[model samples]
Target: MNLTDATLILLLAERIHGTDEGVREAAKSVVKKIPRGKRDLIYNVINSPSPLELVRHVAQNLDT
Candidate 1:
């Protein structure tokens, strides 16, 4: 897995797992860096059952 991608996913996880209000604002800022078409995909992974899934999902998508 790309460390950069994994790090992004991990950081996103940290943000979301914090206070809801901060995450709401932060998510808007963070998601903006991603392409519009892929924003939901990132959000989905962030809310996924496990953090590792985000890493796997990011690695898979990044490889494509």
Candidate 2:
């Protein structure tokens, strides 16, 4: 299925907090592939009030 960038970003951020190291690494790989132009979106997610600490960490580290 073709996921929108926002959806993919949320999912990947969650996966980055997964217990499985491989899954976390794979999520990080995809996150880094996001266009730098999406940095604003990533920051928005990072700053959202309800976002988990791990999710915020992942979003903050996005190369986008």
Candidate 3:
């Protein structure tokens, strides 16, 4: 993924922590603008996040 998208996904992945206000706000802002087809990645990251898993999902979505 490109830098902007990668950055957005990384912040969104931080949502798994729940208590990080900055990350949550940044993620919320970007996630709302994410295309409908790719919203599931946000759910996956929040539910079962890992750096590798986030990268994998982001890369997979980039490919689409």
Question: Against the true structure, whose TM-score is highest?
Answer: 3
Alpha carbon lDDT of each predicted model: 0.52, 0.50, 0.52
Clashing pairs in 1: none
Off by over 4 Å in 3: 1-19, 43-64
Query: TM-scores across all candidates?
Result: 0.37, 0.33, 0.38
Error of 1 at 55 (Å): 13
Stretches of candidate 1 above 4 Å error? 1-17, 41-64
Tens digit per residue, CA lDDT, model 2, 11-62: 5656665443433443444445566665554444444554454455655776
User: In candidate 2, residue 16 scores what lDDT?
Assistant: 62
- For residues 2-38, write the lDDT of model 1, one tens digit per residue: 3344346455655556444343444445665766565
Backbone clash total, candidate 2: 0
Q: In angstroms, how far off is 18's CA in candidate 3?
A: 12
Pairs clashing within candidate 2: none
